[model samples]
Target: MGADRVGSGRGRVGRTGAYAVCGAVLLAGCASMPDSGDLRGVESTARQDTQVRVFAMPPHENASPSEIVQGFLEALTSDDTNYETARKYLTTAAGHTWRPELSTTVLEDAPETNAEPVGSREEGEEFVFSMSGSKVATVDAQQSYVPVTGAYSRPVHLTKNHEDGQWRIDALPQGVVMGKSDFQRNYMSVNKYFFASDAEAGQSPQPAAVADPVYVRRRVEPMTQMVRSVLKGPTKWLGPVVRSSFPTGTALQAEGDALAPDDQNKLTVPLNARAARVGQGRCEEMAAQVLFTLQNLTPAVDEVELRSGGKQLCSLTEGSHADAVAALTSAQEPDYLYFVDGDHRLVRLSAGSGDTKAEPAPGALGEGEKALRTVAVSRDEHTAAGVRLDGKALYVGALVSGGSLGDPVLRSEGKTEENRLTAPSWDVRGDLWVADRDPANPRLLLLEKGAGEPVEVETSGLDGRVRAVRVAADGVRIALVVEKDSRRSLLIGRIERGGKTDGRPTVTVRELRSATPELEEVTAMSWAGDSRLVVVGREEGGVQQMRYVQSDGSAPEEQAPTALPGVEEIAACQDDQTPLVANSEDGIVRLPAGAQWRKVTEGTAPVYPG
Candidate 1:
């Protein structure tokens, strides 16, 4: 729920203020909170980004009810793996029932305590204190993060121990609540890898890995926690399109085991018999999953070797090109970027090179046989798809010079230009996707290998007309620009293929959900990473701006891209090393890594090989 300001500036993006870990609560003094008001108007008490570990102090003997409550809240922000210290502030019975790992509620700032009315607690009666803040988001037990809005109010009951005469909290919520800064300090986002369901069915040339991100405590044996998450599988939202390599019911051979890379940089994982039952090939795939999942997490894990019941299963080493798993899931970078020049002819420039000159693409489309409006290049860069300047015809041609565009692959019967076919997109499966905006007969169509009859995909729950389409590299997730009424929004939907029993699998774009809800209209978008997208759009009454949003709707403030003006079309490659291209006020511009946008040429409809 934190807004990432592009160019937020220097060391520690959005941190300021004093944080005392001695005892005041919130690292120290965070909820140095007001005691009377019932408003979540406090400023963000973001702590500095320091690696020093801070442990929660135990409750002092004979402490007042307020002191006990404040101390307990502070302990929630500490590095107690099991939260044992925080429990000291709770009554014996309450401690036994409290489940701190159930979930985490992140607020805009530290939570404040509002004292109960005077005389509300009698001599032996329990004390009640109110806690509230502006809710930002929540991390479920599975570690999936979802952005939230509005107030977060809850009550904690404090009781005097009859035996010791000291106050302790007797009732509260199941999980801990903390400010956004503390949440960022204590946890980190990590992607767990899985294979596309279609690829697992042997429908694609190679298995493509899709990323599912989850948050985990940064200092709490993260390696082991990550392994456990892998075994548990993907979150419910992504379960339909991806499959885990680990077998069902598979788990560590022993409970409470810690996973660490050895001095030799090899991580040995012990799995249960359920996992060891898999064949050699499947076992290697399992190791491949771990290798990719942890690649960004640490440098220690240079290799992964799987073992179960004291018997070795398989091993996967980083940079091992011959490894079946690595070869199947790794993504190749785009060789060139394509766009329509002033003459409506498709041209290309070497990817990531701002100094390169734009030249006509090899095929007939590049031969300038006919004018073009928008285009998509296949992942292999061997073929290209283009929508005609008139927007009525779609053509497919090879990237080779001298190639001829024989016939229009598809055409729209829409009466107006606005109802013509949208720009085309390619998936890793070698299939082409596009949408016909005809008011009377709108449709989302996919062409097998950019040829043959267009298959109208089934969209059961969609409440709008498709204005644009971009299929993810995994081919399981599809990003669509849908227009409902006068507003256009970006929605991510699952691509489920069925009826494979008859050889022709039917496709459906289901479970459509907003990826950029805060933006009232989304003009263009592209997959910028495995789980994130670079989008161009604006909020209600807001000016056009560019930002990054995760597939799950979380916009991390730290990675905000620099701004550009009047961008109509944007393009990006999965390789972060490549520069971002866009059609802006200065015409086609290039944003090289760590550099400002510079004019590339006068062009439009820029795109990278999908």
Candidate 2:
């Protein structure tokens, strides 16, 4: 950073006459001249001594008239006598009236004069002197003595004439203020000429101008690179077989879309405008995520409804307005709302009631009109993940508050760059736990609030691609599905406190496949209590069963799997131990602990969980 310098316009003038007088007086005795010059030199010596003694006397003393005059002149001319001493001499009204102009004139001409007097005093005292030859011509010459401080210096003049054997002063015929105006015109004119000449010659005698600030431009590229390194580094060095197992093409493209626009700028976009664009993008991304994840479903329109507990909460689709999207992903703490559609748009949503509006559509980019996606609500609702097609990656949106998905709460997105997120679970603190199914680098990602980036926990060592992930009732323990070659396994992991591996924190994983070695792979996992986790999977014979595992990595115990009656897909409640399942052919089912499963709703379409 640079700053401008402030200048105090002030100038100083040196008295050359005073220096000469002091030197001459000091060298008077040392001169070796002829006898004819010696007499004149002696008289000069006496005058010089008298002048020095008179100048040394104080002002208040009752001295002779000549002595008083000499002392006044010395005091005025001495550099030691500052502005304060000069002000004191101007005691009488007339003296005060002339002081400012007299001071200005003396200061301006001091350097040019042979010997400068401080000022003149017109008291009740008189002195008679005779001026001969050139002296008389110099006094009577057509020269103006313009006082620097007075009004007459501009266009004024002063003339002297011998009257009654004394020189008298009077204004010139042009009617100018003699002392002030004349001096001002000359002083100002000189300065103006100097400055104008320097400026026109392009000679910048002053300092340079300050520089401006730099804005952040490339955000998404760096973020994408960071994610790619974190997720793909270790596996890329593995054999080609491992790399081939990973999904490519559309998955990478979709991940790239989700991580777009990654830079942060000091200048802020309008909250309303940002909110609308992000909301629309979020809806589009989420709809794509959900529709793409489905086996064969294709969306005829860009909009969809978000449902909770068998009731329609809000629509996560775009409307007639450009900013209208049905869903948004956001964080609960420090409450940040972000759009999850490919563009990472965000805005802060305030607490209020009624329909929340969106921004207008963006301008056309090319020949085609871009589809604008936004989230809208009939009432308040909590938004979860928005997944796009081809099973590559999705945006995980979680609500942190105790409120149901139908209520407004904090929202956030869990993003994956290359791995496909098959299942996601949220802890009590709102941190997201996601399971990715890339065989070479299968892992669970923990997205914590305030963490600069998501942390990945490798599940490859546990033996399978994760099919489902769930946090225990205590929120610290987690359950995952691992498949080994052709057989599926249930792996229970406790959230480790101080354990770390390879500079990263580690979760303690304990295999629970002893009692259910016949089980192929876990399809879903949920917590039953603070110490127990419920696991669901199908045996080699294709019969699905539910089992329970302890947090300490204990062996598994068989528990009767809650029959969805006719539902095929199931999701556990984040806040409680109950599970909600839906049958593509029948209706929605709710299975609470120790209670027979009950049907929540029966509709033609499948009931989806947010």
Index of the highest-lDDT prediction: 1
Question: How high is the CA lDDT of each candidate model?
Answer: 0.78, 0.29
Mark the regions of model 1 whose C-alpha exceeds 4 Å error after superposition. 1-45, 117-122, 200-205, 321-323, 326-330, 500-504
Error of 1 at 119 (Å): 7.6
Q: Per-residue CA lDDT of candidate 2, range 1-610, in tens?
A: 0000010111100001111112222211122222111111111112232112112123333332223222333333322212233332222332334332212222212111111111342232232111111110000011211111211111111112224222111211121111121122111100000011101111222111100001000111322222232222112111111111111221222342322211321111111111232243443333322221110111122333332233332343222221222111110111111221223221122112111231211212110122112221101123343233333543433233332222112122324433455545554334556666665655667665313245776433465566656554223345666555767565555354345556555543332323234457555554433233445667777766555543333322234456543334444322222233333244434454456765543321111221
Across residues 92-172, which tens digit of lDDT does each residue of candidate 1 receive? 999999999889999978786776733555355577778888898899988888878899899988887888788889999
lDDT of 1 at 199: 59
lDDT of 2 at 18: 10
Where's the lowest-lDDT run of ten residues in candidate 2? 189-198
